[model samples]
Target: MTDSQSNLIDRYQQYRTRRFLANESQTSSWLPGWRTQKRRRILVGALLAIFVAMLAVGVTCHFGVEWAPLLWLPVCLVFMPVWVALRVASGRQDDAPEAVLDEFEIDQRNGARSIGFAVMQSLGLIAAFYLIFGAVITNGDNGDMVYAGGIFTLMAVLIGGCTPAMILAWTRPDPDVDDLS
Candidate 1:
């Protein structure tokens, strides 16, 4: 990369690091009572269920169910922000740069990321197979299938991106009462 490109990338990383750190520091006030493992697990489950619903809506819309998009819009707008909050509440352990994390944290983050990557690869392969076989099955009249494929790909991306944070949130212990105070 050119100097300017490298500098831009570095700046963006710094910004992201700062943002995550800020979130960590302010999480209690911003997302009160969400520090519990049980609540976080619920949030993760809800997010996954929403993603599945989104995929269903996308398929339904492809089949001429026109009102599905109306349901999708509000859900997307609301839940996506919740996903961000979940990442923040989870301490951004999966995303914080290595320098910001301790050895144990780094190992945990890496393991979660590894699992997320594997999930992504598997889902991506499924999406690819769907597109290819779908086109063949339709004798190349695959316009609707393309839309479905796109939605499936997007669902894959969302699930894969969130997996690490979800894993961390679900597995992490509740904050110590002393620590909360």
Candidate 2:
């Protein structure tokens, strides 16, 4: 409330941010915004290609696949976006903590949390089913099982990582004035 108290708090916050950023591994090779943009475009294109291939292989075969290309593409496409977004992001997340956060940020955070929880719950159920039925379904061969598990793992990571950005992008606040240019 008082000037000196606020000043001390601000100093501590600055130190905290600096400390976190310094220790962050991503900072070591963090790309500029333009570079990140290029990477995002490329990644998205790769993902689209993967989706088409997966579709060609049939949706049912998307998971539990033994083909290395099928297995690796989804894994890379899913994980890379998460890593890139976290490391090279420029959003409210990178902004200083505010005494009063924006409603949009708060909503996005909540949405992300909900999405993450749902995905975890779904994954847990699937894991439980596979564990309980492992003998009956795959006796000695779990090649497909492992393949499916890998795909699901990637999906889980992708959903958990991108939920915040997806929500924020989906429900962004309007500009000061809505105008068509």
Which is the leading candidate under lDDT?
Answer: 1
- What is the per-residue lDDT of model 1 for residues 47-76, given as tens digits with 9 covering 90 to 100? 988887888877886675656657677768
Question: For candidate 1, what is the TM-score?
Answer: 0.82
Error of 1 at 145 (Å): 1.3
| RMSD in angstroms between candidate 2 and the native structure over all alpha carbons | 8.0
Q: Residues 1-181, candidate 2, lDDT per residue (tens digit)? A: 9999999999988787676655444443454442344444444455446544433343344344445435456656565664455434323342324333477666656766677668767765665565447637778466555555545554555555554544443344432222111
- Per-candidate TM-score against the hidden true structure: 0.82, 0.50
